[model samples]
Target: MHIQNVRKWCREFAEGHTNVHDEAGCGRPSVLEKPVTKVLFADRYVIVREIAKLIGDVSKTNLDKILTDIFNYNKACVWWVPQMLTDEHKKKLMESGPTHTSPAPRRISLPNSVGKPLNNHTALTWLPVTTSFQNLYCVLQ
Candidate 1:
């Protein structure tokens, strides 16, 4: 709100340029929209830094904001997608579910310590294990 600028605005208003919005003037223009759209359509996994470089000079912060706010993308694992999952997205995810694996069963190991044997051939021990699904303790005797 400089005095000179204010006077200029008043003069413009008096002369009938009465639009409330600021006139589009030269400034740091948006550098991401079109190129980002193209890159994303081509390859969703394209790195953000690479996209920024392709679109000329743009700060990482500004580019991130544009991608998240304008594009509605949030990072999941290594990819970015819409914050809210759509039905089509869910269907695609389900269709690409993990392949079934049937590895041979392996014997579990336990720590060797100073413990008395309950029987001549068996010893009692508590083994703590962490699994992808849950944590549990195994009691063996």
Candidate 2:
């Protein structure tokens, strides 16, 4: 609290105003509600700092709270599809389709003494397989 505020409260108490609570216009009211709503409607993925820049006066922390509490909007995921996808890219994805299967697992030929032929089963035994080289490297402790 400000020293001026403390002194004013003390004066009020001495002058018979027993209520310690402040009067109606103690602090500035929030000016964020409209600006936040407008920006969100324009682009839902806008960053909080970007919105603060647009508003100019609002702090990022205050704007963030207003967004969460009053607007009830969480930050969007950045991992989704890119903003612009070329037609060629879309066509390629469509051709690939949802059920694209990986190539057939190639067999890994190891020395007979080691064990059975290693394929995807090597992954189960906590071994890494180099598919391009078609080989398995065993790690010795």
Candidate 3:
């Protein structure tokens, strides 16, 4: 918490304001669920910022809460899609599996350095241009 807020709270406590929570209707009122839902449904690819622009006086955080808590939506590939996946959708994915399949990744073997100690220079020579750390670690071990 900010020092100023802490000091203010301490002052309030000193003044016999015992309650820790804010008074009723203290912060901004919650954004209406209907408008948010309409905006989201209108454009599945709409971002939080765009929603805020359309619905005046709503913060990004509050917008996120409305999308998740109220509508049960989640951001997926820049689109605000429904969180729950129906059985039909799952079945469709299963049916389309073969079309999405790609060839298996080819593995390259390191040079034989059996007698010599594995050093950075020797390791670099055998490492593929696009090698990842996980693969590099496995080769070192």
* TM-score per candidate, chains pooled: 0.43, 0.38, 0.35
Candidate 1 lDDT tens digits, 44-133: 445678777877788778777777777766443311121233466446445544447743222222233122321223322212222111
Instruction: Return the lDDT, model 3, position 87.
Output: 55
Please report how far candidate 1 places residue 83 from its true position, in Å. Answer: 15
**Candidate with better TM-score, 1 vs 2:** 1
Give model 2 RMSD, 1 decimal.
Answer: 19.7
Report, for every candidate in turn, its global Cα lDDT versus the true structure: 0.49, 0.53, 0.54
Off by over 4 Å in 3: 1-31, 78-141
- When 2 and 3 are scored with TM-score, the better candidate is 2
- True-structure lDDT of candidate 3: 0.54
Tens digits of per-residue lDDT, candidate 3, 1-141, equal: 799999999999999999998788797766578888778666654678888999889899988777777566565321111123345544543453444466332222223312222222222112223544434333322
Candidate 1 Cα errors over 4 Å, as ranges: 24-31, 53-58, 76-101, 104-141
TM-score of 1: 0.43
Runs in model 2 deviating more than 4 A are 1-29, 78-93, 96-141
